[model samples]
Target: MGLEPFSAEDPIFEDEDVLRDSHKPEDLLERDRELEEYQSALKPVIKGARPRNIFLYGQTGVGKTVATQLIMDRLQEDQEGYDNLYVRVVHVVCKNLNSSYQVAVKLVNEFRGPNNKVPTTGYPPDTIYEFLWEHLKDVDATHVLFVLDEVDAIGDDDDILYELPRANDNGNVPADETKVGVIGISNKFTFRDNLSARVKDSLCDEEIHFPPYDANQLRNILQQRAENAFVDGVLEDDIVPLAAAFAGQESGSARQALKLLFKAGDIARSRDLEKVKEEHVREAEPKIKESQVRNELESVPTQSHLTLYALLMLERQEDLPAKSSDIYEVYEIAAKRIDADVKTDRTIRDRLSQLKLKGFLDVDEHNEGPKGGSYYLYEFGDIRPDMVEEVLRDVDRLEDLFQKEITSY
Candidate 1:
């Protein structure tokens, strides 16, 4: 095989990672106001004083965590200049660590590093928390900052939130010397509201709400990103504004806007276009959605999606709504044909409900005759039957079943 040139000519991008959501720029374009407020919250850390616990709430793509990180970087830089103040920041995405014990284990592992990490499981909550406190003491950090991103994922098990902020004061660590601060960042307001009162009080000593960006704000964000992302004269005038408009109309997510820019550029590059244009962004939107749906379908458990497959077959093949009872009958046959275990009728119904909640299916409640109780008839919600069939065919055991029926419609 011939090696490609290291400096191949490219049109769409100067540096593509600039458009990635994970790529944090030196600063956000229009987040100066939020940054100032966030800076004030962390400024006390500069003087060797422990800052208040902070709860940051905002919709996705807003700059809650972004502003936090930028201020943290500033704080760290300032602390570096000081002789007495020392600061440590440990960031963990609590989505993957759902339980308090799991989060504590993650903290212990993060502090200890990979070679000496603890197991993800098998540790009791107390032991895990003790391990975390021990790591805190061992590091000798005068102040420890924990950024619990997507903290809603911790759900009802918010023991970590209740305890971590008070660890030093609670005698888990030496109270007089080191201070620990927790910053909880969440996209869901309901999750924050639903938190235990004790957890909320300790974790929300200071609260900030990051409102969704307006169209102009999103455009500014895209503009900052595009300054580094695309080469001059590559993107047409309408590209950034249109992407921002689309993202604004939906959720005003800067992440979505950035993703759109990346997707549009990617599409143009794949098609060997000279530059990214308005049409490229138009084409990229559906591709992004298709990819998202495929991923979401893949994440559903096989048994759960088996129930979905049954509904897909019923809804598409027979051109009818699928009742729980009818879906179970089809599901049992499909399960047996695929050499899989058939769940109980009740389990099948529960799976259907779960699939509905997952946005692949919709359920309509209906009352039959006076003697009959209400029943739910399932149909595709945001998902199409063809797409469901298409995605399910990716599973090896179900490949043949998703194909065209030999006997016709």
Candidate 2:
């Protein structure tokens, strides 16, 4: 008998992860400049000199991390050919490690036995540094490069940024010790400017900016991902281009293109269709938006989440962007209702900036013609109210408000 609910016959996907954001494709399409810079930065490891502290800043899905990882792997592979070049790359995605203290602890624990790893919290920064130094002192590699992806998550803490590059200067490592280099990657463009002056001058020695993908570039990327992800003749003629156009026109993000194609196939497969088609893409759009909106809201800082939730509430009655003033008013009400302290209006504006940079929201400054000066308005970027309602349902106090007010509105 044939399969019932899930078909055993050959489906569209050969490997679904080929389009995943985290998947490191064997070759990156349409990012030659970025790949060259990534390789250039790591070249110093071959000469036993410290690589420049590289700051790779760009929008999400623009291939910053992918280019870096490719160079990192290549650096390690090339080391085997030369006895003198010992490049040990310790790359960590520091998105979840919020502060300098937590980052320090994480580096130390990387060398620790699983059972003896340090706790997520507690322990002084100095102690964590000493332990991290202890791990580095014994490393046989000639150079160590710490690739801190999403480095902005460390907040204003300069300890890790300053100390890692100047590890030898601080006596944490010996003079002839393994020279350390830092590669900081962030989607937040202003994160580099917000870094302490000294950290900027040192840690941001070389900077590379990755721009958003255009429609043609997104098509190229989507074609490559589809090549690896699905069988031949599985997708209709309009599927890839439609998904690419959608992603390019909106986010200009390759990740969005890949995910859209994947989701379209998923919709087709679920419907038992012979081929993935444009109608399946139409069905996948809102589903993808809901998941993306929910994930982005969850990833931001706690205050950003509060601000977003407040904006969602303000837009319930009228599905329009609320001004900064209006958002703050609703934010205060939300804070009191949730038993959270209200942040200053200035701080709320900064939160909006952060959220906008991360692509969760959009900020528009409109100039009133004659008498009125310009004021900023905020809207959830491609985020729908129902997605917000879905996430807010998990919050105890917000559930009633979402059920009664948001759903109806």
Candidate 3:
């Protein structure tokens, strides 16, 4: 073949739209059975009867939120003629609403809409719930459907989930009349197990488990996106399957799969290539992983970040693995520097364990019962020293901001 006068280093895509679409569950191909199951869960509300609370537990990006939203739209449309059906649905993401009172205040503010704002930390718990109850009554939202995505973030404070289902029973409304159903969505199956017995019994009337999509399923989903999202013949035949395989291997997340497709396309475009190929997908893997790591670093709880910052600082100063007691000193100083609330040493240790579980740090055990004696040490993993320094530098900027708040106080 004669030279086409194009750069060999560049790839050209047939179409670019496939790389840009945000996928919803309905957009997912070959998940009809799961979709039907989700639809069936909302069927009772259509007949104007009380709905059962639902718990949706699954891995991240497995279509939990998308499926819920899809079914909710159908329910709202179908229930238009049911006169007694005072159906109201509110979706709250609990990642940032870590406290029950914060959640209650958020619900009240959501109900109030544009006219009011609730302080994140200033409200009394009872007062906040009172407002929430009043708002529910005012809207005549007796059949209230509350979906708390990432319900695990609220930790020990599951009062919103527990009390919401029993709101009518507690005299907030008539005992058997004011129907409220909660759908708690969690990434961790252990979240329900950790809940108080009372809370678990009330909030988990019916549970729906969403499993990760397999490789073939991901291929079908990606193919569907390619058809609608990309221009004709823009993607090489292998690109879709390759992206699908990577996604399945990583976490079986459609979000991750779609992100990979987009990143590959961006790489193609930047290099002035005409079509995205399997090679582009390979090239984009590290970029995707780096972005994932960055997002994880950004989303950690403030206290956890403080603990990590302490470890990174200690590591910089010492050669050997550091013990908990030594790290606690650094953590206390870091917390005070940030003007952040300081938990007890045990609490900090627990936070460290949580971080380890999340795969951000590594813990080492040493024997010292006798001559060698007993000791344990901690070190960070996969997280590089340079990366640690960068995170700490950014956190120090945050410390400066916190100092301003202290002075204002």
Model 1, TM vs. native = 0.76
Better of 2 and 3 by TM-score: 2
lDDT of 3 by residue, 163-186 (tens): 887776677845345567788999
Error of 3 at 10 (Å): 14
Count of clashing residue pairs in every prediction: 0, 0, 17
Instruction: Report the candidate with higher lDDT, 2 versus 3.
Output: 2
After superposition, the stretches of candidate 1 with alpha carbons farther than 4 Å from their true spots are 1-7, 113-115, 293-378, 386-409
lDDT per residue (tens digit) for residues 1-409 in model 1: 9985576677878999887767878877777777777777876777777768889998777877777777788778878789977898998888766678888888888887668888987877788888888888878678999999988777778999999988866888784567788899988765787888998878888888888888899998899889898988889999999999888876677877788889999989877798898998898877766665676686565577778877776775774587788888777877877778888999887778777765778788899889998888888888777877777888776765656343322
Q: Rate the local accuracy (lDDT) of all candidates.
A: 0.80, 0.80, 0.76
Give me the runs in candidate 2 sitting further than 4 Å from their true place. 1-7, 312-326, 333-342, 352-383, 393-409
> Model 3: runs farther than 4 Å from truth?
1-27, 30-37, 81-83, 116-123, 175-177, 188-193, 336-349, 367-375, 392-409
lDDT (tens digit, per residue) of candidate 2 on 315-375: 7667457788888877777676667778999999999887787676888889997789889
User: How many residue pairs clash in model 2?
Assistant: 0
